[model samples]
Target chain A: MSVIVTPTTTGAAGAGDPTSTSPAPGAAPGAPAVRSRFTRGPGRWVVLVLVTVTALAVVAPFLLMLLNAFKSPSDYSTNGPLSLPTELYTQGLTTYWNQVNYPQKLLNSIVISGTVAVAATVISLLNAFALGIGRVKGRVWIIGLFLLANMLPQEALVYPLYFFAKQVGLYNTQLSVIIIFTVIQSAFGTYLLSSVLSTFPRSVLEAARLDGASRWQVLWRVIFPITRPTLSVLLIFFFIWTWNEFFIPLVMLISNSTQTVPVALATLQGDRLMDAPTTNAGALISLIPCVIFFLIFQRTLTRGVMAGAEK
Target chain B: MSTTTQTRRPHRTGTPRQSGQPRQPRPARRERSYWTYFLPGAVLFTAVIAIPLVYNIYLSLTRWSGIGTPKFVGLHQYTRLFSDELFWTSFRNSLAMIVAMVVVPTIIGLVLAAVLFDYLGRRFRGSVVSVLRATFYLPQILPVVVAGIVWGWILRPDGAVNAILDAVGLGSLAQDWLGDPSFALPTVMLVMVWVQIGYPVVIFMAALGRVDPELYEAAELDGAGWWARLRAITIPQIRPETYVVALTCTIAALKVFGPIFALTRGGPENTTNVPSYFAYTTFFKKLDVGYGAAIATVLTLIIVLVAAGFMVFQARAERKDA
Candidate 1:
């Protein structure tokens, strides 16, 4: 597992150049030296094989689901999974739509996710601006508290939140889900935004202040434009997170009418295991919006979220 | 009032000099008012985060079911947890998943980053790199339930995987991927790896970008091979990133719940029950809130301990370097 092979050959090839002439005799001049380094005769094949196997392993399951969505139950069970369908089928879609209440569930998910994203983004902006720009006292303590809150698992807080929602008469409502998600996500959003804000030049804000702008005007005019890219990134992320969230929706929204896509999908799994195609179709439907969202915001998503440690 | 304001302007400007010269009289009045701006945010933070955090800790110690008044149960839930085979099994499964999720993905990510770094360099790199990263990260942003459901269909007995296996004339390899006890945990771990690979890839790529190209040039001049340069320069340069990814992924692996909940539901003789799911089941399904809290509290402690260990190790390493 821990093979330590010397790369002396490649080194030798590099130093053999007449211009360098500093090292060993076997060194070659200016040729892209290939030492059969990790990707040697068999290692190349081995690595390729592993990558192919892993890719297949990753891709095969989704492909299977996609194919299963087009197959009849009898066809799926009797025929080999890899085999061509005996005939085309659409019954699965109809079954999935009716059984899972796909339209209503999808609508609920979109509304809740959109609301949460917008609310979280707006709240985060305000909080970030206040903390980032305003010379508030105890700023460190406030930011530290938010960071600590982010570290706690949502599971630990969900129960009390549920009770709190019930007490406030927002239980089983989309508003309740939206509020909870927004508030929970705001902690992290504020942190990210504040970091971005910190990177903004203080001199720009000072100039704006000297221009006779009020505090609100300075935030609106000077700060908001510069932070649009960061804000958009946060919006996309918050949207995806809220859209993909499962546990909170599962716990809080027990009513079938209020169920989001994931909760609805899970319910379908529990209730309709017998109908493989319908379940597959339901799962596929759930994946569409996320795939689209991902495609649209892929750049910002990766850059904003992963760039921290990447740097 | 206008006359007084006109007279006070000169005194106001003079106040700073008087205070500086006389050491501290009028300035004390302004200092007392400084706390006012902090009042709102501080209060909101305490109300939303601090109170709830304390409540969660308290809940972790109690016997309150979702529907009822609480009873005090001193360490009984914890002691019972020690004897619970399911808890231990889930904990072990989580540990295995962590190794699979963190170690495998980090290696794959590093290799992918190296390949991209060599191929793309800088120009036109951004677009291709972003697209690939997004594709890989797509699954992670999807709800775990969705991921589980989608993968479940793919791994079904006659699902996509088997279809491909049969098509390729290697039909013997196909099995009930999620349903079979032998394949369930590994199957979940693989899905996790696929969903998770993109995050580390982007991270590694960013780290790779920061590496000075001159080092590679110097290494090349020194007759260093690709692997030599990578081992000597690349790995050490990105050590901080590696630590961050490892710690974060480990915590994520331990807390995994949704995929297991959606796909296996800990089926095929309870093979895929991770600790998070175990706690959920014990609380909600089994209606043993106290026991579940015990499991959750233990899980939290484990995470905290691991995180603390990483921080301590990192600090010591940094100190040694210093």
Candidate 2:
């Protein structure tokens, strides 16, 4: 939510804004006066209605999924998809969960996303350290290279990676996807972190160095503490991104035990055993963690997005 | 090289020996050791990204089926790709994707961001604005496969959308959204629009933050309408971000795979086949490795060109703005 309100706060006009030409009633100094076009009566209602309708439309699919997921197959067939469920039917969830080995799939997703997030963040920190604070030669070129790597489609690299994983006997293992994503996710991380680090205050590093801090110590003790916020944002993003990854994991982690939640659910699409309610249940289960993450880190995720766009 | 090292050696040793004298270390010399920090990332990038990219290109020039020696066939796959009808259809469908993912979303998002910034933030409570934005953005947080699953069910013949359409007495409009050739691509496009709209809205809202509020005030003082002000000030002010959003979303549109995989699998006469899915199925399902690489290479080229074009436009726009 600060995502919406932040623009006003960060906008040019503020409480201390010295450019207050005409003060409005009970507003921060220099804030826009109430004379704007749509702020008046009737227009405000129109805008509110439009925005609310659009938001409801945006959420319509989720509502449909939720409604049907708990509806029994018999209820759905008799009354159609839009009707209310007769009871709290949970057989769909249990059937899909048991069929897909939900716990194992969740574990696979967690292990892969968790490992990739930490490993990628660490790798990116090091990479950014060299390119940003160290001001390494060809830093611009190197950062550009990382940016390009991030932009390249997974299709371009999937086959070769698949072939290599088979050759190296790492196919069908969660570790393969973990390692692959660590590099891929860190590409963006390095790009973002390098840009952030490039603008790091040189005086702080100089102070640390003068206090007898070695290069490694400066990285750990000085830079790490200062950049923890950005790093945490990157960590959450990496974890979620890795969890949501599909193509590579679909190709590499082909086994049931190794497949992540998304890959597992996706493979069951249109299967003989899957009912409408079962697919909905599976999808609902898969996105529960993501919804939870969104609720908890709404501010952080939005901040990261802003940071990325600005970068 | 020897002479240069010899000249620098005494300066380095002398600096270390003079550490007790409160002397500053040569920043350039200190930076040299940081090279070691980049080693692991470099190796990983080379193996994961660079090498695979180059190898994929190499494989595109050869004939292989994921087994045996890849026999080098000069320009064979490229020629085959040029003649492939499905390949042509896939690229053509990418246009639909661009409209859904880039063009429509950007327009709607710009206006929505303006509303949130210009009207809602000023009129409503902060919580209201936040809740509205979150509702718009909720789909973005879900995995694409989850989105795919949810939309797939909703758009099914017996699904909620059709059921609602029937109940509303618009039964004639109800059809098999994903299974039919005619409606599949457009339905998928609609889903893509939903999946993508929040991204630009969020980014543009942030862009709007950096905009000068006084512009709106100045325009209002001149009696400009809301749309007039948005047109004259907000769009021009955020052209840079518009470019960024367009480029990133276009690239994502071209590279779309998961939604297609989960929703339609490029079925109903392959009407919804985009390049990424085409390449994926060709590689894995059909076992046509070289052709898959060719498809991926073509898609990659198009994306790079689009990105370059967007950046050049952004640069010119920024220059004009400045």
Candidate No. with top DockQ = 2
Candidate 2: where is the Cα deviation over 4 Å? A1-40, A299-311, B1-23, B26-32
What TM-score number comes out for model 2? 0.90
DockQ each: 0.18, 0.42
| Candidate 2, B62-89: lDDT as tens digits | 8999999998997999999889899899
Tens digit of per-residue lDDT, candidate 2, span A181-269: 99999998897777667667666878888777888889999899777767877788788888888889989988798999999998888
Those runs of model 1 whose alpha carbons end farther than 4 Å from true positions after fitting are A1-57, A299-311, B1-49, B119-132, B158-176
Q: Candidate 1 DockQ category?
A: incorrect
lDDT minimum window of 10 residues, candidate 1 chain B: B25-34
Model 1: per-residue Cα lDDT at residue B203: 65
